[model samples]
Target: MSEVAMKPEIRVLETADADTFWKLRLRGLKEDPEAFGASLADSVDATHEEICKRLACTDDSFALGAFNPEPCGMLGFYRRQGERVRHKGSIWGVYVAPEARGTGLARRLMVEAIERAKKMPGLEEVLLTVSTTQGPAMKLYESLGFKEYGHEVKALKQGDLYIDEKAMMLRLHD
Candidate 1:
């Protein structure tokens, strides 16, 4: 079977997968700096132990990995912690490698994340931000039922480039 024809194994990444997750995350940050809120430099000093802590799955937070026998795509979801905001969650660090872009891997990861979010006890809505430069990603989120609620001008400044970001949200229930 052709590699592209095979379904990727998507699962919640755990502590042991931290190293793999970190490498892919760095690539994502570096390869598409404007698409993410964090830069490669901000993450380079993060230790393996810190990544393991982040990957430790909890009822309200976890990271998903799409593996074609190795991590290729990643997305993070975490519910708000404070009492007033606990009903909301945010999706972060969404990335799919160049090789995986057209294979529907990103959509699969998103569907899985939304499904998981729906199961959380107090999760009423999920939110994420996308740079205006990411039109394809914005379209994918829209197709998945996310609505743009706001726009931030110059949300991120990378060198001389200023990225505007759209904030989008998906409500799980009425």
Candidate 2:
């Protein structure tokens, strides 16, 4: 039998969503170690207060959540702080619940994040890094207009295994 897919409604996560978001964030880090720059062991003990502070958004940075009535995915955007670097932003901590894969939820999350980045003052581009082995994820980013700009060897290591990543960027301005 074929599976039915449900669409996710995307929104900017709020302070009230800290616990839910944090739980999912930890799951992503633990379940998919190579896909992230941060490690589960490093952040597993993070407090709810810390997560709440992160859910708090400013004019330049925030996390977007995908809701199918529940928080199922998240993507974060952050603008560079210095005056000279404010024109650029980065997409981070992108994760979708395993059961929600193939439902176009991730593409929606990226689109939402990129659209929001485009509206940020002085921001002209958004950047991300994806592990070379994550072909499906790389394909999604490429399909969304993120181009590979460079590569780093052994960028992330879990024990003796090293994972490489390609630096990618999507231009928002001409």
Candidate 3:
């Protein structure tokens, strides 16, 4: 049997990584406009404070970065609060640089995010939404054990076009 190539190192983002994280995030948004709700054009005029606020949220949230001597991708998970919703967490803002796309960085990021979700205090499952056009992303998530639990019709409107989103979930057993 052939051997699988090992992936580059991945680690949780620390306070010092805020700028690097933001740069990679904006790059992802710019390159894949249809994959996310946020646009680089909109974020271009955003202040450093706005970007800091986003990168600084780590209380019940996790932001991971994959590196090959430099940051190449990022993925984040935010645990739901409120007594009723605390059992769930949402995976959001997943992205990999174009140069890193075919190297399995996305899968590595998802693996780290899922492991983090499984360790959350009361989390029963993790949820994420993907645009219907992102078949590759859908396949990656599904391969990692996420099920297509539901879909939101015309959930996003982009310049006269309506896009549907598929809601996916991965359950962690008690």
Q: Would you give me the overall lDDT of model 2?
A: 0.89
TM-score of each: 0.96, 0.94, 0.89
Q: How close is candidate 2 to the true structure, as a TM-score?
A: 0.94
Candidates, ranked, lDDT: 1, 2, 3
Name the best candidate (by TM-score). Answer: 1
Scored by lDDT, model 1 comes in at: 0.93
Residue lDDT tens for model 2, 27-81: 9998888999999988888888878777668899999998877789998888889
Clashes within 3 Å, all models in order = 0, 0, 0
Off by over 4 Å in 1: 1-5
Using lDDT as the measure, name the better of candidate 2 and candidate 3.
Answer: 2
At residue 140, candidate 3 shows an lDDT of 96
Question: Lowest lDDT 10-mer window, candidate 3?
Answer: 1-10
* Local error of candidate 2 at residue 76 (angstroms): 0.5
List candidate 3 segments past 4 Å from native.
1-6, 57-59
Deviation in Å, model 1, residue 12 alpha carbon:
0.4
